[model samples]
Target: MTELAPDAGFRGNEKLKGALLQHAALSPAGLSERLFGLLFSGLVYAQIWEDPEVDMQAMDLSEGHRIVTIGSGGCNMLAYLSRRPASIDVVDLNPNHIALNRLKLAAFRHLPDHASVRRLLGEQAVRTNARMYDRHIAPNLDAATRRHWEARGVTGRRRISVFNRNIYRTGLLGRFITIGHLIARSHGVRLEELAETRSLREQRMFFDSRVAPLFDKPLIRWLTRRKSSLFGLGIPPQQYDELASLASDGTIAPVLRHRLEKLCCHFLLRDNYFAWQAFLRRYPKAEEGVLPTYLQEQHYHAIRETTDRVTVHHANFTELLARKPAGSVDRYVLLDAQDWMNERQLNDLWTEITRTASEGARVIFRTAAEDSILNGKLAPDLLDQWHYQAERSHALNTQDRSAIYGGFHIYEKRPA
Candidate 1:
């Protein structure tokens, strides 16, 4: 994992206070702190670092459609950008995630070139990359964001700060996985070894024998009981309730086992670069391409250029949707954002989503529970107006990068 610089000044700050409050509510059972110490032992940036469901066949970008996405780690946004949409707006409540998105954007725009950009973010080597950021990238940051990134750390170079500090809680589900890795490492088995597999069978074997067995241990199982611990993995408290229901007595291992199986056994480990990043390097796919996209180098520039039309917002999905004009967006990628909301929040989010629907606009999101969030929670009047692409959901989930998410739902707004 890239070591983020230490934030010695974090104590007594509002950000720390907010994180504390969030951790308290998210981990009400009091197990999160211990699990957190065992796992992260530092700043956590929980993120779903995988791509959102991308359906190239159904999407005709030249038809001109605006898109809104939850933008966990902005991977989906970059992938979506490859389709050449009219515009894409990405929102996230986590400031760190927002900053991470900006950093990604900066890398795309200002790095010495594509190769260097890849080296900086992919390999995570920061010496020369720090020079690149200090000379070019830092000047482009918005004031508040600049301060956020510039907060001094052990590394005098601000870019190195991301590596020097603990950045586990910034995205969707990454933080929890980071926590898991830390904890599992403390127990002796290196989760990073799962990345050493040369074949799909080896990957499967490593997961079953070396990796999954660690979770079966008594202490790890006990740690899984905490909402905060799960939150670190980007499992919101509300979703944890549903996941608990999946087992007879609401045990977490079964749910975790199911998720891990999907991640390891369901796909080719060599092609699943997201898994390689999570379990091995603790970074995104490098410039040379890692797994799935390694062979698709032709799409790289198209992907890079798509960055221009995308704007990252440091706000919740509901808040972002609320500001959008009616019928202005054609695609929505809400990656398990509903898992974190209450019914009221869910209603508001869908209401704005429905209000913003353009003709044949497609909205995609994931859920912790097998069921879609729209069932009874969304009023029938609005739900009925939109078409659920259940078949498409199944197909995409099968193809999803990490395969850890439960339900991948797609909704299409009827023509006005």
Candidate 2:
């Protein structure tokens, strides 16, 4: 919010297009890229999929460390405040994401108490949220961010009204989950029941009995074959290719099934909020289950006190990094953005990362496939400056509760 210049809405959309539109206008892949860009230009993730707890562990975050990260849904960035970082520089190509990060920071600074914050962001659908936004949150927001919330959505409601409804069910990812639920219901499967499972055994039983079979359905299988069908999951054309290649049969169903299994069975539903979003379409009640770190009560005061340390920029990661002084940042959270990059973009990003990274800096990111995207893609000279913690990455990847990404990677800068 601090560095976002005026007309960011236009500039961010163009930047998003440049990042996503990798092919020509006439080809099938090009068309899919265009379509994805259009949808991605709007609000995509209502809740970020990467598990911030895993991220914190991988980065070994310490007090007073400077961090740079992609601002998706804004939860993880705020959650990082709990570690007492000296500062956090958040960059994103989506204006909606920029507005959202700013809004969340303002909510922390202005909202009266923890319950007020929770009701607005956690219990997102309460009617009082709109009133709360107008009374407490709105006045504190920067003009660009305030305008973003006041803008009307396709439903002809001010975007802020999404809180009055189910905010989690309104974004592109939210709509995607809704469609998944509808499809499952059409087959007479209730995904919500997975949330009620008492044990991992019960979770596996639910998946084996109610969920896994859907992947084998002809309609479901065919739909998975289409790259566009996954745009809601924020999978772009290049990433779709990476994910499809992971399956021995050259299809995405198996990969989807594998990730969904991890989400359903590997983690307890009582603890994983990502599963709650996927199945229940909203976070559980405080008395019922867990919430993201930023939304939890214990972290509220810490985050609010440190809200001033965050700066949201409507810009590309590499571009933002290029502006920073050498050896300045201690941690980097890419959050799967490299999966969208080509060879040149990857190199440009790493060049800046290596240039800007502090001694012993750690970088964490996720990928759609079960390997670091940097292997063979990033230039050897730039890549050699960093040491890949393959063993630790594999260990942490398993601990990520979100379970959507195929791999979690950590790279530490070698002593210069």
Across 104-212, the per-residue lDDT of candidate 2 in tens digits comes to 8888899999998888889855888988899998888888888888888677888888888888997789999999999999999989888678998999999999999
User: Which candidate leads the pack in TM-score?
Assistant: 2
lDDT for position 214 in model 2: 96
Off by over 4 Å in 1: 1-47, 53-63, 154-159, 163-179, 185-188, 283-297
Backbone clash count for every predicted candidate, in the order shown:
27, 1
lDDT of 2 at 305: 95
Model 1 error, position 339 (Å): 1.4
Please report, in order, the local distance difference test score of every candidate based on alpha carbons: 0.63, 0.89
Give per-model CA RMSD. Answer: 5.5, 1.8
lDDT per residue (tens digit) for residues 1-416 in model 1: 12122332223223322322234535543344334333332333433445543444334444256877765555566666666778888775555556667777776776656666555555543556556667877888766556666776464656345533333323335544666678888878888777567777887888888777886788877877766656556454557777887777546887888777777776666656667656764544443235333114455676677678888765567767787788788877777767655567678878898888887888777787788977878878888888888897788777877766777777878766
